[model samples]
Target: MKTHTLLTVQEATALINAGKVMALAGDEALLRQLPKGNWIAGTIPYFIADEGGVESRERLYASELTQVGAADVEIKTYTLDTIKNIAADGPDNGYTIVILPARSAIHTEYANHGRDYEGMFIKPIVGWIAGVHLDDLNRAAPKVVDGSAGAVLAAEAVAMHVTLSADKMAVIHILNLFRQDPDADVITFAETGFSASTCLVNGKPAVLAEYLAAKRIDLKLPLVADYNGAQINTSFQGVDPDGRTVHFYAPVFPGIEYRQAAPVGDYVAELGALADGAHGGVQFSCNCILNYLYGELQGRKTGDLYGPATFGEVAYQLLNQTLVYLDVRSVS
Candidate 1:
């Protein structure tokens, strides 16, 4: 397993300059200094490392991909349409690092179909959405790099798909603390859609106003859907009063019913439990920004787990308030 680390600009520069395949997270200014190579990067200032949680603009959170017995690695860039063919043509056993600018049309598009691509993926993929500080989230757009050109402020996404050795295989998984609030009212929708701002409840297709009015629901607690035993989360962002629509941080997939998640308790302990089980094989990982704020993770350690705290996490699909990770193991 590869361990992630915090690096100084000079240190990171030396590594990238040496042809390392790195996934970077940090403030905008420092990420631009590295010489372009086999790497990808995103903007964010929060992380949970061996040193515990901390936010910084001067340093970078880096995950070295060239480790874990990768005999060869290839880095590539793509627009939304171009990326659709990755699995048909990419390495048979590997992982892709995806970094998309928040709120872009491509971001919205990918959020809806990330899983649809999974069927075509010859390799596993684990990635996240780039983000700015909470205060500048709406004002500052996130950035991504492909190394062929100068670091770019992405209008869409910049992905690095790596090809590992034949003896090694990439594996992807997610860890979620949220569970369905069984005690809460069962909410059902009539229509099928993705990224829906409004949906019918008990045959009434109004906004969340009525639902919010009747139930003592916590907006911070996301809607959870069980997919093949995996708890996928979608969070409530806000509502449009005029349109009677409710916005979501991630898409609510068509035809899948969802239930409000129960509030999480003792996140540090829960994180500890998750890390204890998964830390050994994790090569790349990212946690949701919501977990950091809602769990009060700053200045706390999640065992040996380390990675950026992103706006959204991707593990075959866009997810909210979850931790996603990738690992590679020898076939023999």
Candidate 2:
């Protein structure tokens, strides 16, 4: 593990200004110190702003940023739309830059607003979202927002810029991890009886219930249960030939009523056996939702809204356990 030192606002700002990407600890203090005009993404506070304020734009100080979330450490901001305006369309690709609603103007307004206003107002303000575009993937021209617009406009600019940067970093991390394990198979399971329709596996595509019915087994099996461990009996559904779609009784896990079919213990054990060689191993990644569900099952709750830190801890535990199996295999 790398030792992480918390950086002050000025130091963080300077690092960002120097064009260095920062891996933040995802704490409230770090979120507040995030420099304006730089992109950042991690769990931050999210909330709706209260009406009534001084109507002045102000740069958020470290102290003010801490108090911005619904709870502590969460930064509540707005979702802004990214608009690309093309001036001249051609292979040249040179474009003009325009900031809509003007982020500076919005920040100024928020500063003007007195203590009566609660929460960060992020909306209505539109601007160019900033992030490193891999190749020509990001060819859109910069957006233009008039500075004289409302606070929402400026908030939008801030949100878009920060989100784009954060998203870019996330993509890079994911890709790097994938590169480290190119042949790893992606498995998915969907829970039945959810209003959302279908569940996705590894974010590739959704599996509908109707498709699973084709492979259905005529048996009254335990479908799912809620967090209370109450089992709901449902018809045993068939799985796809690829072993991806599984229709089973829903588990009592809260929020999710249906249980998606997952690989049985035997399958996992077999894979572990294969990777048992002295130098071989396996890597696994999962959606944070799974960690949240497990935490709920374990009755562990970290008040942090984003819950990335909690997920990280869970991941470490799982990884260590996987290594233990590999160690056994090597010795055998």
Candidate 3:
């Protein structure tokens, strides 16, 4: 059975602290419950202590800011003390904590642990923590991967790892969806292994536009490209199916700089065709950061720290918004 509720960060943390959630070898039940939305995964590769520099470390966070839509993102900083407090106080305190690390400290710790070390470590680091809320614990638990429990270990086996800016991109995507459909339900799905060019819509093969159409939901698929490759118009699409006329607004990829090279109008039209049963939408997938860097670093790496963390944030936002969209009444 599919679990319909989303979980908040607070609820998830409590579950972890209480030992309500358990890790399994490829737990399908847990994987199935992840929230659904635009999933974006990234990583923070561990460079050799001597070779690693401050500028490179800063670039990781800086790259996140450069993603397509990140302007309205809300970034917060958290410390070990604050995390300990949340563990003690419970979810009512109401805040998500993201840890950012000091480059020098991370480097020194990496040296002590040895270049080939593989383990999860969290202590003085710089990062932000943020998330939306949902009612159920099951739904929220997957969004968080605890480094301490051997659940989300670092790829390079270091003790100090922190979140950078890609988290902001996840936030922006959720905010955009909320702006469009305040009541839409959010769902998150985390990938332990990266798959290429395959996306599942409601457990079926279909693109975003096609899924929207199959449901008979009257909405316009926004054009995202040019018809003749002449010019591009950036806008969001508006639809009123009953009138038989849908309006394609300009393309909007706010906060993100690398715009989709294709014209917005074209993409919208393709989406409409999918809705009309005339075509199928495109499939999309992403590579895991660990897998991408595996060859570059020659050593025994155990797990993916950055990829799972990114998945956790994306899943958190999707599940949070989904509960809001469904207007699920609170349970005592």
| RMSD each, Å | 2.5, 19.5, 21.9
Best-to-worst lDDT order: 1, 2, 3
* Residues 1-332 of candidate 2: C-alpha lDDT, one tens digit per residue: 11122334565566546544222322333344455432333321111011111111121111111111212111123323222111111012111111222123332222223111322111111112211112322342212222112122224322211111111111100100001112222323343121223554344555544434543622222233222542222224345565554432121222343443232234223323432233322111111222222223123322211111111111101110111110001222
> How far in Å is the alpha carbon of 319 misplaced in model 1?
1.1
Report how far off residue 239 is in candidate 3 (Å): 25
Ranking by TM-score: 1, 2, 3
Off by over 4 Å in 1: 1-3, 68-71, 190-197, 202-206, 241-243
lDDT comparing candidate 2 with the true structure: 0.24
**Tens-digit lDDT string for candidate 3 (43-70):** 2222111121111212211112112222
Model 3 TM-score, all chains together:
0.18
> Model 2 — which ten-residue stretch has the worst lDDT?
170-179
lDDT of 3 at 4: 14
Better of 2 and 3 by TM-score: 2
How many collisions per candidate?
Answer: 0, 51, 42
Q: Which candidate's lDDT is highest?
A: 1
Candidate closest to the true structure, highest TM-score: 1
In model 3, which regions exceed 4 Å deviation? 1-59, 62-95, 98-174, 177-309, 312-332
